[model samples]
Target: MDIQKSKQLPKILIITTGGTITMTPDSTGGVVPTLTGNDLVRSVPDIAKYCECEVISFVSKPGASLNWVDLLGLAKLLNEKLADDSIHGAIVVQGTDTIEETAFIFDLLIQSDKPLVVTGAMRSAMMLSADGPANLLAAVIIASSNMQSQGTLVALNNEFHAARYVQKSHTGHLHAFSSPACGPLGCVLEDKICQFVKIERKSPLAMPKNEIASVGIIKAALADDDRLLKNIPALGYQGIVIEAMGAGHLPAHYAPYISEFSNKFPVVLASRVPSGPIFTHSYNFAGSEMDSIRRGAIPSGLLGSVKSRLLLTILLSLNYSPEQIKTEFHERTEY
Candidate 1:
């Protein structure tokens, strides 16, 4: 624990993971994660003015390398920590590549009403104008504010976005994270957290008896065949999220495979488009969203492929039957 400020300030846990934010130029002329939680906090000593922070180096790996078990473990740790009345909130620092998914997973599973924020930088700390320190400062400021019960938030580029709608819009831009369909929930400016939207937070999912499950997400492209789709179940995947083409429609040839897969494992239909709800009706095509659901696949509603996979994995880990999974999936996806 590194507290360089007044004890009267609210306390927030700073959980750091390896990401671009913690990376530095390595001897091989490439950026690598080499900073600890304490190092990151020290970079933004101004955060101490907002809250007394506890630094915990959770892991030192790129966000893309973080797996389902890492997410489960992080959520468990946050839940246990926030359950203590003395702890105000927590901020998770990791790579931006997976920040949206991490935020959404924590949004679904973290029961604490205290504010929970996830943030990372688009550039490495060695970059000329690295944004990690500013982002980290913004996140901790939000955590110390009255942003309670607002669900998981992604803070970057001085903006705060809800977990459900926020996504990585660009690869290298400083303003990489954005909530497409829905605008950002808030922003940090002049050291103040200002919110512009209010979203209905998801009811926290119960901790699964099994913390591990395999789910694959396949994006449908033009002329793509079902060879990869067929191999998913053969590879022993427990569930699937198909990033179907516009409005959740696959090729006519996929209709049969959809039926075959949905019969054995849960199939979730999410749109390839960045923002919008999955169409529930009005399409008569063989592989339309309605057709897929009729064939036992579930609709992802407004969720994209990345998030649907996480939700489906949790459902499968719970041993949910296809029908039961359908019911829960629909309820959770609905606004």
Candidate 2:
């Protein structure tokens, strides 16, 4: 971990997208994204000694407000920068609210072997004991290391998590990100990076067209009716993800409506539980998981509702047929 060991150190790019990490107090007692990429680098001067750095202030908005178009643009920018022969790796700073989705999208779009890391903070930069500088330093260290060729990563609280498995489990804490199904890939020590597990990379997906399909998500409740479900097709929704109840079951009254909806459009059934796969044959009631599958509801194995919605949206936008979509779900969810 000596910066002066090699004649030419690795060059890293830090792409800044506004989040709590870059927000400052405004006149009305609220905070806004006023800090630029240069400001962040100035806060932590140690990063410059580790690697040659370049900064780009991409966007300044909350993660919830970011849509598909914004993500597409960010992916394209990252691809262009990583394609450069001198740029060894890149780090993305964005809001934690949508990091899971954005990181997964980057994982799908970026085809380069160079490492890409995403980091953010729960507390604002002006708060006491702000965690932004530390998190950003760790991310830069990971990006500059010899861990190239690994897939996208989320670095926070000194832990490195794979983009496919990481999630924000807590609302207010320094250690909010975690990988429930799979543990973190590594941890950043004082002067070294330790990797405990290795992850296999998947093939990159083609860039989606401008006209992406509209997708919706619905969470099944105890006594939920089918009024909204029945109106989705008429409302112009191309795909849907149902956050079904335990073991991925709906009420008996919803079974017929689910079958009817599935026949018209792609309906995915995912469990509401946090860290488990959708059950295939645990129950056999009229509205059980097996029944839904029998009625053409595709099971979203271990993917949560949010991730399932994104996958369905991308697949439908790319014009994948129903059978091809089903096969993809099977292949991705296979343990």
Candidate 3:
């Protein structure tokens, strides 16, 4: 831990994992994880203007490569460090690919209301107009400010999004991350944290004794036979999230598969589309939302496939029964 030069600055912990924010081009022209937490802290020249920062170079891996073990370890870090009264907040810097997922996971796992902001860059550090430093500075500002218990948040492009609602809309756009279902909670302007909305986070979950539980997702595409659906249980998956067409519909032929999965595992019916609630009563076709429910599928309201899979995985890891899992999903899906 770096000793603070001044006693008055808000103390923020800037934990770094691997992402574009920490990467530079290699000899082969590919970007790789290269920067440490202290390195990132130095790259942002104006960050000191916002807060007194400490760096934890946690891990250096692409967001897509991170597993439950790494993720749970991150949660443990945040929960432990934030328990300190002097620490104002934590800023998690990593790759953009899985920020939405990790942010939501942290939102559920972190017990404290202290501001926890996850930020990353779309462009590599060597690229012209790299956004990492600016984003990091913004994250520092947000971490130092009063968030008033808004759950975990994604701070990028000067905007702060609620973790539950944020997603990576574009693969490489500077403004790639957004909360389509609900807009950002706020943004940073002129080194100040601006406030707009407040999200009532659900009760924090316990760190699972079992770090992982097998879960799978199958998105319903055009003419998708969903042939892979039957293999979930045989492959030892404890939970299945069907990314059904529309609100919650597979092809009419998928009825048997849905029934089979529901009978064997906790099946969550989530929507493939973004930005809308999973409709439960709007449709009544053979494989519609209500029909799926009639066939014993649990509806994931508002939660899309990715978040649904993460939630199911966490619940299963906690050893929740099918009925208990259904109740939890129902509760989380609504709010």
Please give each candidate's TM-score. Answer: 0.96, 0.95, 0.97
Looking at model 1, residue 85 earns an lDDT score of 88
Tens-place lDDT per residue, model 1, 246-273, is 8889888888888999778888999999
Query: Residue by residue across 48-157, what tens digits does model 3's lDDT show?
Result: 77678878999999988988889999999899999999889999999999999999999888999999999999998889999999998888888888774888989999
Instruction: List the candidate 3 regions with Cα displacement exceeding 4 Å.
Output: 1-3
Alpha-carbon lDDT, every model = 0.88, 0.87, 0.87
lDDT of 1 at 252: 84
> Candidate 3: global Cα-lDDT?
0.87
Q: What's model 3's TM-score? A: 0.97
Residue 44 in candidate 2, Cα distance off native in Å: 0.7
What is the lDDT, from 0 to 100, of the residue 48 in candidate 1? 74
